[model samples]
Target chain A: MRLGKRRATPLPELNMTPMIDVVFQLLIFFMLVPHMTRVNKELLELPKLSGTEDQQESAITINITRDGQIIVTNEPRTVAGVVEMVSEEIRRLGGDRSRVKVLVRADHRGTSRMVNQVVSALAKLGVHQIRVGVEVPSR
Target chain B: MRLTSRGVQRDRKIELAMTSMIDMTFLLLIFFMTTGGFMTIERDLDSAIKERPSGRAASSDLEPAIVEITRVGSGYVYRVGSRELTTARELTDLLRKFPNKIDGAYVRVSDGAPFEMAAAAIQSCKDARFLSVAYVPID
Candidate 1:
């Protein structure tokens, strides 16, 4: 009876060391993954508009800075270079340019000429529909 | 002897209270997860670039409404055909009153015009309920 009473008296305590380790690992992962994925996105002051649609996944992202610089996949490219890169991307998608979706994130303070040049190049490649990134105005 | 035994028992009871630490860690994890999802809350504005035949113009009545955006010193000027406007709000109101709404609208952005003006022009066209908005690059 004494042995049974002693066994019941000791409550089971959960070992939190392993759990804490796993939680820490997850915290680190969540912290690092976003930074890694955002490497391709250049920091720019995007245009704000109230009538905007939800952004969808795109096959390519072209960033235009205030100085009229264009960056694609984290590499700066000229208008012609951007055209070439987009064409290559289209070819990789089984030579179907229509299947390719392009996202253009242009700085609000940048000249329209840069965005226009990029759009013209994309148009020449038969990629008509393009997504322009903008910030949703907070009401 | 009794005092020594009590001290030993007290030392055993003074464990690192991991409950609060675990709770805080979980709270941080939840916070990071929720905020990380919002890091990229950018929306999209869809624009189309149609390839017109080399030397063909649509009929006069079938032409798309053109909104010309030009930079004027420190400010910008928005022109939808002959009517000139200083603000995007006025542009939206004018486009809303336009009669022919089927052909959509063409936003012609000049070289030096800022991108915000162009985006605003497009947004105005959308706010007016145009079926399509085309970005026209003027060199």
Candidate 2:
């Protein structure tokens, strides 16, 4: 009787399907997550209105850039010009000037006086509702 | 078919090429890993606190008293409601004299004002120990 050694069986198993699925899932997550774009550096660091109820969205956002310039709707304007424009907008909106809300967004580096002028202008125009926008200060 | 010796030799070369394909896949992975670092965004302010005021927020009642200061050629003028303040001491005194009314005083500063002048206004508030001080823009 001739003894014949049996040939060893090679395991044929290379499963790549699970690994590819994980890589594709990670790619989808990165693609769908919204990236935080650039923020306006000119806006003031508003204090968080902790415990305050949600305010109406009627407030106008005015930004003040560093170097003491006023920007209304992204347009640079002088103090007087801003007042005039705000006045006209109030009139067109058909609301009581006293009821019109003014939200001032000024950079921290922006001088207090520049902000003061804008607030003074708003007050002169009879805008009674004025809220200072600030980022909530960390404890 | 007879035992194809040449075919077996070619098959060995193809097995070596599989190793080369894996090397290329690793190179691609490293390139992508390095490029993924470009998505970072820097923030100037720290964490934010959400503010939700309930009931009649006393802050809304705080009347904003504004002082405008604009850079003039080389100097600055401190104005209240358009009236220029001649002296810092006078402004400080005015802030001191503000009545302890139900609505706390709101200090609005203009952007055109110098940093020194703005600091003075804030200092005045600090000296008076007014807790409800709100710094806003004048435009």
Best by lDDT: 1
RMSD (CA, Å), each prediction: 5.8, 11.8
For candidate 1, write residues A53-129 as lDDT tens digits: 88888878899999999998789989999888888898899988878889999999988878888888888888988
iRMS for all predictions?
A: 6.0, 10.9
True lDDT of residue B10, candidate 1: 40
lDDT of 2 by residue, B86-126 (tens): 56667767666656533443444444565445545544554
Q: State the lDDT of candidate 1 residue by residue for B8-112, as single tens digits.
A: 334443245587577767877787888765564588888887544222224343245788786667777987655679999998998888787877788877778
lDDT of each: 0.78, 0.51
List model 2 lDDT by residue over A1-139, tens digit each. 4356434444455555556556656664675454322232233433332212233343465677657777776567798887877787788779577656565655655555566666656656766455544443344
Worst 10 residues of 1 chain B by lDDT: B53-62
Question: What pairs collide in candidate 1?
Answer: none
Q: TM-score of every model?
A: 0.79, 0.40
* Best-performing candidate as measured by DockQ: 1
